[model samples]
Target: MSSPTSIAPAARLSDVHVAFDGVDVVCGVDLHVAPGELAAIAGPNGAGKSTLLEVLAGTRSPRRGQRAVPGAVAFVPQRAAIPPRLPVTVRDVVAVGAWGRLGPWRRADASAHAAVARSLSRMEITELASSPYASLSGGQQQRTLLAQGLARQADLLLLDEPTTGLDADSSRRIRSVLREEADRGVAVVCVSHDAPLLEAADRVVRLEAGRVVGAPRT
Candidate 1:
């Protein structure tokens, strides 16, 4: 397994704050994620866990304080926001990861396709590569999304309740996959209300009223 200490700090939020609709969502958060670390974010409903993940993923900018994130980042939202009628195959979705590196004008070459294949294989979804993404079960869809992130070679992976609504077996599989990714030097930050998931993490952060209420401990 890749050591968490092996990779430098890839993300940091110093007293960060975020607000929505005149209400504060995240309040004065001070957090850091090192590469290869499996960090879990736990909090009550409406505690801003999802908001924090979004901020780190660059989907939402912080309203205050300093935020620093480096390298490639891949985010999997709670709902897996994928189009149902996109007409793109499962493999095609995973290949989208290479788009940023390939740029808009260039096409994905052999190396990029190889990465997509490896990612699909790693997630054990190679058999579904040609299938329509919408036809897969919830677990399969989540795995496919994970494969997409892996194909991107993301140094940081921010996941928001990735295991929500999954069966116990499915959830366990997803957790195992995340552990493998962390072992491979991908920083993993997951937000979940599930206590079991928290136990598997190297460190856990708790929040209340959008403020960190407890220090993270291994």
Candidate 2:
């Protein structure tokens, strides 16, 4: 992985603030994530970690400050955002990531299929490709969602609580995949409380009451 200072940032936020129902969730935070770096946002519940990620992802606009992101970005929200009863297969769900490039009417072609396959393999869910997404375990579903994000072939990847509630092996696999993605020159950021994930991250941004208390490493 290249040194963070050697390359331009893939995502940057300056003096960012986000509020919900007039209550501040993320306040006066600044962040920068460079290509080939894995950054972890760690905080307790209600600390605004997920909201900060959304601001970086351009999904939720901030109440104040600036966000700059260039190139394709893939965001995988918490598992609850995906309906458990959906009838899509694992492969079907992952293939949707390519639809952005395939456009609305175009059908999936060879390259699209290859992208989905590669993503599934990276998450170690290739064997579950044909299975119904709704039938999988929480860990399996999380991996599938991550694979979907990877299928985007994005320059920046953001995830929320990916290893929450997952078994040890699942968490380990996810951590490994994150490292691999960073090594492949994708900027990766995840909101997580998991110790292993935080420990493995190249940079850990600690948040408290929506404020960044420390960012100790590059």
Q: Highest lDDT, which number?
A: 2
In model 1, residue pairs whose N, Cα or C atoms come closer than 3 Å (at least 3 residues apart or on different chains), thus clashing, are none
* Candidate 2 local lDDT, 82-153, one digit each (tens): 576778899988998887657789998899989999999988999999999989999998999899998888
Using TM-score as the measure, which candidate wins?
2
- How accurate locally is residue 76 in candidate 2, as Cα lDDT from 0 to 100? 89
Regions more than 4 Å wrong, model 1: 1-7
Tell me the RMSD of model 1 versus the true structure.
2.0
TM-score of each: 0.92, 0.95
Residue 209's C-alpha lDDT in candidate 1? 90
TM-score of 1: 0.92
RMSD of each: 2.0, 1.4
Model 2 scores worst on lDDT over the 10 consecutive residues at 77-86
